[model samples]
Target chain A: MSDVFGVGVIGAGPVTQAIHLPTLARMPDRFRVTAIMDVDEPVAESVAGRVGARHSTSADDLIGDPGVDVVAVCSPHRFHAEQVEAACYAGKAAVLCEKPLALTVADAERVAQVSRETGVPVIVGAMHTFDPGWLGAKANWGDLQETVRVVNSSIVLPWNARYEDWATQILRRPPPGEPVADDALSRSVAVRDAVLGLAVHNLPHVRHFLPDVESVDWAESVDPYGYLVTIRGGGIIARLLGNMHGYWKPSWTLDAWAADQSLHVEFPPSYVQAGSSVATLTSDTQTRRFGGVEANGYEAEWLRVWELAAGIVPQGEDLQATVDDLIYAVRIADAAADLVRGEHARDRVR
Target chain B: MTEFADRPHLVTLPSGPAHRDIAAALASLPRSFRPGAGEDAIVYVTGDDDWPASVEHALSVARRAIVVIQPGYAQPSTVLRLAERAATDSVPVMIDYAFASNPAVVLAAAAWSAAVEPTGILDVTSRHAGDGTGPMAVLLDQLAALHSLVGPVRTIRQLHIDGDAHSAVVAIPVGGGVITATLLGARTELGSRGSRVRWLGPTEALELEVPHAGTAGPGYSRHVTTEGEQLAPTIYENAHRATLARLSRHLEAGAGRCDDLTTLAGHLELVPREHPSRSASQRTSDQRAN
Candidate 1:
């Protein structure tokens, strides 16, 4: 029961080198980065060297390191399930995993199963859902679930250089592979992964307002880099879309409408410490706006994860709920990719 | 095609007081303020006892566009046929939906295509705080705006409300997505009288809120986000002023009808052949017209 706990982070890439380490530095008194690991030994050693933590080329070695009290899975999306399962089985104080929460529904469920059996608190980094401003808005909205009419979300984002360059530069990252030759199945899967990557960030937030996603109406890829999806259920419909393009700045909004009341949540872009997301509610009698909670979700997320790891908070969220949220995101992605492929096939015939 | 020889005069048959408000609003304008026609821009017909007959005569004699202030379109077919005639005669027609003409509605419509393009799933909720709009007219006016956005709707499927005053969830097919409108007539405590239209796609999203007619303070057109915080002052004109201004633009642009019959046909799917049909504002127009 040491006051300062040890944190072992797997994947010493930008997220670790840039996001978590900086966030951990801000909360130095409560937690420490003990062991860092990545597939690339140089990246592991370089990032570890700066943070004063040991480096490992093997993820298991880092997870099992004696000084490590908490395990953070920040590796590629596909590795989330196994690494999270490994960390949970290792009985780390807690496990913090970045999202998609492991690509497929089955993988997500398996990871959930492991977390449950191990009784280790696991948190998915759907950061905006953790913001104080969003929590404030959620607290204020009442009876909207039953009365919501339409849910519309729009995100127009620019290049990542705005925040990416703010931290330590990783100049020697591996280049991305060429696009996989598109067969019907691979094209559909690619569309699913691509859509999920951008849109899932908000699915967790949208579910907070309307949870019943009975069926997907139509999901289409708008241009080269984004998707437009409409999901219906819970006596309401939700329209969700996000794109990465030439925005003057980041414009991301989750808007929910009801007969008398509406909720709007605006999220701050990633990798910065600007301010918390802003949420405003408008109703018949009055309109209320909330903001100035200067801590961003990225920072807030680390603090919360540290609190749970330190047994300071009641382990934040349940695995089942996280699984359902992750599954909903997957459902949206699959539905959208299926639709785009369907239209493509139909177009070929015509 | 060559342009009309002279500037078009605005012809508004004396329909009601609301009708007069519009005609007066137009007549008050000098020819220079309006396009084409000079100070002699407006002709307000006073001699006719038969309302429909006067419009027929006015349509023939008027040099340019015709204005129907709240044409109850009691027989939707009759007014639509007149619009068709106006189109054939190369005359533009403006059917003014005054409540919808507020600066907010105009500005939001102006912002739609550029800010957030719709990818099929276009949803609109038309609810009156205290049943702000009459039975079928509420659906029609809202549908008219929707037609402009989603192209022609192909079908409309209506769902029921439980023990509610008058609530129906109507889904209409347009393009790749569907336009769903939930019209609640008898719920004031739950919400105020206003219409919110939202367009959502993968790349962009937008929501526009239009308050019920005559609800706002004068000279107030401001842009606000979905959360109801004012964004900026909008370029707004009164719906009455906007309808006329739009007509002038149509005339200048050689405009005939705004939404064609095919578009109306798409809208007709939402209106049952025998829904309690009446022009909600025709009474106000009649009071003013006489």
Candidate 2:
């Protein structure tokens, strides 16, 4: 193996610092941070200085960099489809974009379509799926039979920016674009997308590990302070929750069951935990822990993506399961939108 | 609306005749903060409706923070405002759904909290679906989910779900007296999951003799059911003792000592019933009569 995998990152925000940068940094033999792109030259330069990557002012520049073997899109939700499409079009070996895949189903489909056309491996950033603890979780699924009627997932995020400052700053900079369409009041709808972004990350894990979900009836409880969802699928009644107020809470948590066995995971909330970069898994039978690179959760995900890119992991629908989860996420998001618009009774929809 | 002229610290108005006594009791609570008591207390709304701004105003004055108990009827804008205010004031705010059986509220609360500071959100939930599900099913799910999030802190000292479809009580193992937490769910006509779990501090099979509606002596033997069969009191005691035995594992692991448990539990204590205030003429007459 080469001393480094020569990776290029396209975003200079918390996610990049916490996950992408440090993950590559930890495995000097498997990956290397080669370049980064952000609209704000100074911010991009600062991140490049810390991660030892060259700075670029535009996405095109980062993609065209000769040292860049892979491109990581860590921008806002809206930019993912376009960035991933561009990376694949450039004949990059792999394309990894942050979750939700895209803000709209149309864009996500477009991105997937383009990647298929280009024959580039596109891995959606669903880090929890690659988590060793989740691997341990799968090993212990049989123990979760007795108490297994419901799965509750809690991904309580901190006050992280909805978009990297550079992205918004770029939007405001040159050729002023049309005002982005979003919810008018309290920016609740805009924030709802972020919830979907977070959900897409964990939903795949739930779907992959739990018994097959036969049908899903989900509703979004629109509290501006937070969002709550109740999903009844595969005879399991699961609740996925996100909040921005109350008290600081762990960012990712999973509680599931077997008839008499239980599994519990409590990790540090978002960036703080990401900074420390560790995953902890506890069950009735045993406890397992993993991760501690400054690279955050993204590093492990990057390795998984590298595996796929290297053809070590087979590709197909199984690889596209994240897309299925993303679609489920869309259905959930649309339902939430309906509830917020008063088109449907909140409880009736569920 | 009754004039609250005399109740200065009362945050909630007595809604109907059924709640009048509880309201009077709330009106008389000592306003001063108690030592070891958390500065925050959850003020829950028992019904579904848009929270009135007056609710926020009341919380702002009475305490440094507040959490509205809006389960099935939470509005996104309203939730956002509550969170924004809480964030601005540097005070924690929570939205509670202790009565929600629907998963929608849970999802919404989770989403709302994730959009803000992670710590700003706390979800308190049950592990099982209470769709007239059998007691064992409910207990099993509840224990599983509870252990998943915060490892089980309390041991089972008493298990009671009445076959009479009346009231039932369970004992939660605490430091001192047997904390007998009772459930009021069985008493309702709708069979709603409105269980009131109370901790009856330390005792040994200490059966309190209460006068039944007509009968006397031990109204009921505080019956214990296992797999739905009423075990003899001696047998029940043995089972209870055994269950408490498992909790020692947690005690050894330093688990059940979470500070939030006692603080959250303390709010469940029944407030003292208040005596009616006398008018000037009534006071004068009462003194003279005395």
CA RMSD per model (angstroms): 8.5, 20.5
User: Highest lDDT among the candidates is held by which one?
Assistant: 1
Among all windows of 10 consecutive residues in model 1 chain A, the one with the lowest summed lDDT is: A173-182
Return the lDDT, model 1, position A332: 78
lDDT of 2 by residue, B1-290 (tens): 22222212223331322134334333333342111212333232322232435345534753433333322212323445555554555443332222221122222223222222211122333322222223332333233222222233244322323221211222333223222222222211211122211111111111111121111112112211112212122211211112122222222343422222122222112111121111322354345559
Q: Give the per-residue lDDT digits (tens) of candidate 1, residues A1-350.
A: 68788999989877776678888888788789999999989888888998899999898798888799888889998899999999899898888898867888999999888877887889888788778888888787888767776676766565455356556674543433344343556556666766678777788878876687787766555433555666767666666766554323466888777767878788877776668888988887888887658777777777777777777777635567789998888777878778768855764574
Highest DockQ model number: 1
Q: Is the docking of candidate 1 incorrect, acceptable, medium or high quality?
A: incorrect
lDDT by candidate, in order shown: 0.62, 0.46
Model 1 superposed RMSD (Cα): 8.5
Which lDDT tens digits does candidate 2 get at residues A161-267? 42223322333323322322433332336335645856656677566444444433333332323455555454455556654422222346775543334555544
Candidate 1 steric clashes: 18
* Each prediction's TM-score versus the true structure: 0.71, 0.51
